[model samples]
Target chain A: MGIQEQYRSEAAALLSSGEVKLVIGFGEGSTADRRRPLFARTPEEAQKFVLDAACIANLSTYLVTEGLLSDGKKVAVFLKPDGIRSVNILISEAQLKPDQVVILGYAIDKAEITALEGRNISDFSLGEEIRSHTPPPHILQEAERIEEMNPAERFEFWKAHFSKCIKCYACRQVCPMCYCRRCIVDVNQPQWVSTSSHTLGNFEWNIVRAFHLAGRCAACGACDRACPVNIPLRLVNYRMGKEVIDAFDYCAGENSSQKPVLASFKQDDPETFIL
Target chain B: MSEPFEPKIVAFVCTYCTYAGADLAGTSRLKYAPNVRIVRLPCTGRISPMFILKALQKGADTVLVSGCHPGDCHFTAGNYHARRRWTVFRALLAFTGIPEERIRFSWVSAAEGAKFAEMINEITEQTRKLGPFTQYQELQKVIETQSTY
Candidate 1:
């Protein structure tokens, strides 16, 4: 059988044997080229799980659906290396219990799909793999080009993109790391971030969004793809991700037990910028 | 429109060190620029990045965050933690095209009153040369005029 069929049968067995209460995977999307999240609870439903190169929404997001694991039951979910990284970070952040998450890990290269040889979060050792993983070359070139621009030009470039924001927050909804009970943008008493779709609010919202995910982001690129206006949201995440590594030697989601960089610190962290 | 421009500088200082240092500057009769408005908190760690953005949103041309030196933090590693946070925050600001020069970070102990006064004067001078932060001020202006709609 093909990799997709193999995983489908595996998913079905997990449900039939009561090993997992839910199997989160990809189903057919509205378009042929697009795939949407599919949650399978029964054995029959598991058969509908579709595994392919187009199945790239990072299904680990569904695992944090607020109280899904409160009962302490296992939930199997389809995951790529990025999704596995998200799980590691989530487990490290105390957002999920590793024992309760069964990772149906897979990796996609080009147009081919292949199953990874891991069923548990700890079975995979991905620290070296994650540290070497770079974003697409064009993304790197664009980031470099942005860095070379004068502050005024950079400001205008981002302002132009942010102006198109309609405050839809499709990026926020799709991020597994964004599983906050109350996001900073939703706070009203102090109103740290403006709520309107205007440029001012958009800047604050986007900044806060990127700031919150600094070293915790798995670089899943979900936010970039989910953005309705195509704000190149991942660029800022990439920048912050790079900053954490270059400045502090901290890579997010390298392992399940790593301490979050911002939460922990050494006295010797570089402070040359301070006067 | 031709009036002399005085840039507004918001200084967020930790109470134990930087705030006390500013007090020393006052007691010593050290005259610094009057452009700064100081907001004192318990520790540098307590000063969130949001405070810096808020200062800009409210029309401040620059922000100064001063705290105890790394080893001298009253709460012992608070400055260290704040140091890490600001390093990350500074990069985020720079990456998003915000003028990194507008936000300053420094260590000010209670004994360094002269340094406090001199730093304030220097920042006021630099901000004066840079002029009002119309880039951010203009963003706030849109909110005021368009909020009615």
Candidate 2:
């Protein structure tokens, strides 16, 4: 049997035996090249699970749905390394309990699908690998290209891209870390970020979003994919990520037990920028 | 001749240290640049990154964030935490193409009144040299002229 069949049987068994209350995987999407999240509550539903290279969405996001784990039953979800990293982050942030999630992990490389060696979060050694794994060359190259520009050119560069933002906030919607009950943009007390027609406010919205994710981004590329305007969201994320690593030697979601870089601080952490 | 441009500078200071430092500067009768308008907060940790951006949006030509030294935070670790935040936030600002020169950070204790006074004068002079910040404003005008609004 193929790997897909193997995972399907595994999912079916998990559901049938009541080992897990739900199996979240991919079903056939609208296009053959696409995959949609499939939630299997019963053994028959588990058979429809599609484990393939196209299953890219970080399914851990669904696990954060309000009250899903309130009753304390286990839910199994198929996850790539990035999705697993998201789980680690959520667990670290106290958003989800580690015992409540059972991750069925996979990886896709160059259109090839392969199973990652893990079930429980602790079963995998992802910290070292994620820290050492260099991001793709294009993101680095683009970041460098932007850095080479003068301040004026750089400002113009971002202004052109951000103005295209319709403020639809699909980027915020797709992110797992963005599980705020009330997002800052939605708060109107001071209304620092206006809700409408202020283009500068739109820029501020994107900047604030990127700022909030500085040391916390799971690097799942969800925001970049979700963006309708193709604003190089990853480029900004990569730059901020690089800053935390360079300044504090910190990597997000690298370890489940690791302290969040911003939340905790060392007295000796670099402050050269602080005059 | 037309009046010279006086760049608007907003300084966000921790009341425990920098604000006290500013108070000392005044009490000492030491003169500093009058260009700065200071907003006092409880601690440096209270200086949100949004405060800086909002200052810029509200027509400040530049912003200065000052707090206690690393170990001297009135809350014991507030400045240390604030230091880390500014490190990340300042980089994010630069990456988004905000001129790094436009945002400044410093350490000021209650004893550093002269330092505070001199630093404000220096910032005021430097901002005067840099002239008005029109980058965000120009973009604001871009959105303002659009018929979509």
Identify the leading candidate in terms of DockQ. Answer: 2
lDDT of 2 by residue, A150-216 (tens): 8888888888888778889898888988989998889888877866745687789999999999888
- List candidate 1 stretches off by more than 4 Å: B141-149
Decoy 1 TM-score against native: 0.97
lDDT of 2 by residue, B1-149 (tens): 97989999999999999999999999999999999999999999998998998899888999999999888988999888888999999888887889898999999999999999999999999999999888876666667676342
Task: Provide the overall lDDT of each model, using Cα atoms, as 2-decimal numbers.
Answer: 0.91, 0.88
* Docking quality (DockQ) of candidate 1: 0.61
DockQ comparisons of all candidates to the true complex: 0.61, 0.74
- State the iRMSD of every prediction, in order shown: 2.4, 1.4
Chain B TM-score, model 1, reads 0.93
Judge candidate 2 at residue A142 and give its lDDT: 90
